[model samples]
Target: MKPYPFSAIVGHDQLRLALLLCAVRPEIGGALIRGEKGTAKSTAVRGLAALLSEATGSDAGLVEMPLGATEDRVIGSLDLQRVLRDGEHAFSPGLLARAHGGVLYVDEVNLLHDHLVDVLLDAAAMGRVHIERDGISHSHEARFVLIGTMNPEEGELRPQLLDRFGLTVDVHASRDVDVRVQVIRQRMAYEADPEGFAERYADADAELARRIAAARALVDDVVLPDNELRRIAALCAAFDVDGMRADLVVARTAVAHAAWRGADTVGEEDIRVAAELALPHRRRRDPFDDPGIDRDQLDEALARAGADPDPDPDPDPPGGGASTEAEHDAPQQNPAQKGKPQAPTTRPSAPPSATFRTRALRVPGVG
Candidate 1:
């Protein structure tokens, strides 16, 4: 398929940004693009593959995992011919192996089989695959940046699998008539002259590639400040999110974003953007809310955690004297009413000791 240039893609800035962030820091995990049909979801992802290939100076190691592939095609199995003829153990690399140190794109991911999805999760989490099937037992590195695109109308992804993605972007179809026209025009131009169209955006693609390389080099050095850390934690706490995964994702994503922007230290704005992407999928109770992360609640928590842009000179602290006064003035309830059983009025005597006498023995060989 002919892929449009990454620079020429119409809308969905967040999707593009998320993909670029993964390119910069693969450890941030994969990205999921959720949208309607014909929103250029797959096209944008392919374009990113092209850019990544050019930037890394390697053949675009892009491997597309079709939904109809069998288990052997994905994780590999024994080579039947070699095993039957010469009694030699031969191993064949599968899609996951081919995608090593590259991008693995999955289309209609929501409709994929549950078992296959579990395999993907294992590979993504462990960065390797251990196959012990068909008289074969071996493990190989399967590290790859996973990118999945799905249309919500088709099906819903399981919550456990959805939460594994580091970032989730909801893309909308372009509504502006002119923008849509431009999209069509560019696509036609690319179809008419693929080489010319690619060349037109060559410079822009090169610049983006340079930026990605630089950001990756600087990502490890980007410092996450204490205030930002507290803000991230507070947001997770206020959202009633489960586990520490959300906090970790937010912290790493913010650092990558800061590095992308050529900043040495992560700021409040970086954390806010990261939280918007990472915390949305983690809303345990309200998964379908359009605005997953409550902006007002997050804003309040940020202010409380000293991440507010315009802070009051003396905002009330988290554990001020007011809490102490409230604790003291609060009325005490009876032990029974408080759901606590009253202790025995007198302690019971201990059970009688065993009648057996104690004896000591020393080894003759050692002191």
Candidate 2:
């Protein structure tokens, strides 16, 4: 299928940003796309593949691995004929090998078998795959930028596998009438004349490619300041996130944003946007909750960071500390306190009951 040019995608700023981040830092892990059908998820990935192909100077385009593919197709298998006839091992490179240094797009990823998912996850996590089947063994560098698309209506991915993704984005159908009209118009034009439509966006695509290359060069130089790092930490904590992955994603994504904008240092706005995108899925409680990243907490963090240098050490409370006092005085009991009274009395009851039952059972005629 022909992918619509990356620049021609109408309005998926978040998805675009996440994909860009993955391209900048493949170490940040892959991206997961969740949306309904016909939302252009696959189209966006293919467009990204085209953009990345240009930037990376690789002729091997993005490798598309369909769902429910066999293990032999994904990680390669031995050549049975060669082994039987000549006693020589021959290996065929699989999708992962072909995807080296490029993008690996998996459509309908949620429908893939658990074992195949594990294989992909292992390759992604280790940046290589090892084969030891059929008395043949070898390892190949199989690194690639993994991009997966799934429709939530079909099913949900296991949390373990979901957490492996560094970024998750949701794409919704277009709502604006004018934007929809534009989308339809563009599609019709492309269908009428694919090459001409592609040519029209050629310059735009080239400019984007230049920006991606420049951003890649600048990614290592982008600095995340102490204040921004602390803000990211506080945001992760406020969201009750589980691991250190959230913090790393926020920091890296913020730096990528800075690089993409041609800045050397990350700013508060960069961290804010990154936190919104990176921390929502990391939250352990209520992944779909509104204000999932604790907007109030983030706002307070930003205010503290941007406040005047010599301001008052203590600011006046809105209600003169009454709310703070009430919160302090609220009655509560620790688990230790609640269980102290019941610990000692239940230890002596079992032996006496046993003795009485034993004596009564010796006289069996009484009942």
Candidate 3:
């Protein structure tokens, strides 16, 4: 079925902007959308895919990553069907390949297995997938706008995977009765006639598509001044984010924002908006800490950074790519175990008076 138009969605200005910024500069990585159910998260991703398809003139439609998908299915493997049918050992492209130049939509991303999440992180960081299995060595471009939607109540992504996403938006169902009624009306109209409803907003979507293409062209050329870079660094530092990913994402996103606005140079507004989207998820110091940015703090940090006359750039700027060794090598934990209490370590009843050739025993393990 055709998706409801992107422009037609109401009351998610931040969500829409995050998606658009990633579209403008995919190097900013992609957008992770955190919200409760029935908030049009999937709808917006599909609509963005539609816009990308129309803009790029490629089959840039949405490729969904099902919660239960296996690594081979998510990344590509030997084509067993072809091998059986014609005795040809060909490779069967998976979701990553199919998602190239498009949007890889992962719904309930928090429910995905750790291995699958790792695969996504790798692909998002490198813009390609490499597989060496079944005596088949294969690699292909897998660049796409990674759109992950999750209900935080269910679980949380590991900090490594979370940091890989350039932007994050926290959305909620509108509480205003009038706005809720309008949402219902639009949804009902779309359900009643998807094509007709889509046609009504076709012009708007087309215009957005054009703008996205233009922004992509301009993003690289958009100048991020030293002052803006300092502001980004200060914002990340103020947030006390653990690594350099936030700084790079904010910088890239600010440039994208400038491009999206058709500006030749990035301004304070661009940096502020970028920090709002890029720093929220990165602000959590630990798994238990809540994911969000304090707006007043963000404003204060930006003001202070902007006021300071620091001609020097950030002392320790990250290398070209967004990926970091800490992020790449971070341990993966079961998503189900996230946001829950870990089993307590057992204490010895008494100090071991004599430890002779005893196997190293930790203690009673959780069942």
Task: Name the candidate that leads on lDDT.
Answer: 3
Superposed Cα deviation of residue 208, candidate 1 (Å): 0.9
* Per-prediction TM-score to the true structure, in the order listed: 0.80, 0.78, 0.81
The deviation in Å at residue 356 for candidate 1 is: 52
**Candidates ranked by lDDT:** 3, 1, 2
Tens-place lDDT per residue, model 1, 1-367, is 4467899887778889999988877777788888889898888888888877766775636899999999999999899899899898888879989887778999999999988988887787678999998778989998777898999889789888888888888888788999899889988999999889988998998899889888988999999987678788887787777788888888989999999999999998888888888887787665555735678877887777674354344544476645555677898767666767756589889999989988998889987
Residues 84-166, model 3: lDDT tens digits? 99997899899999999999999998888877887887888889888999989899998899989999899788877887888
Best by TM-score: 3
Instruction: Write the candidate numbers in order of decreasing TM-score.
Output: 3, 1, 2
- What C-alpha lDDT, on a 0 to 100 scale, does residue 315 get in candidate 1? 42
> Please, what are the lDDT tens digits per residue for candidate 2 over residues 1-367?
3568888988888888889878877766788999989888988888888888898897667999987589999999987788899988899779999999889999888899988888887887689999998777889998788888999889988887887777888888889999899889988888888888888998998888888889989999999887677777776776678888888878888898898899999998888878777766677765556423567877876676455254344444776665555677897768768856645545545454444443434656765
Residue 86: error of model 1 in Å? 3.2
- TM-score for candidate 2: 0.78
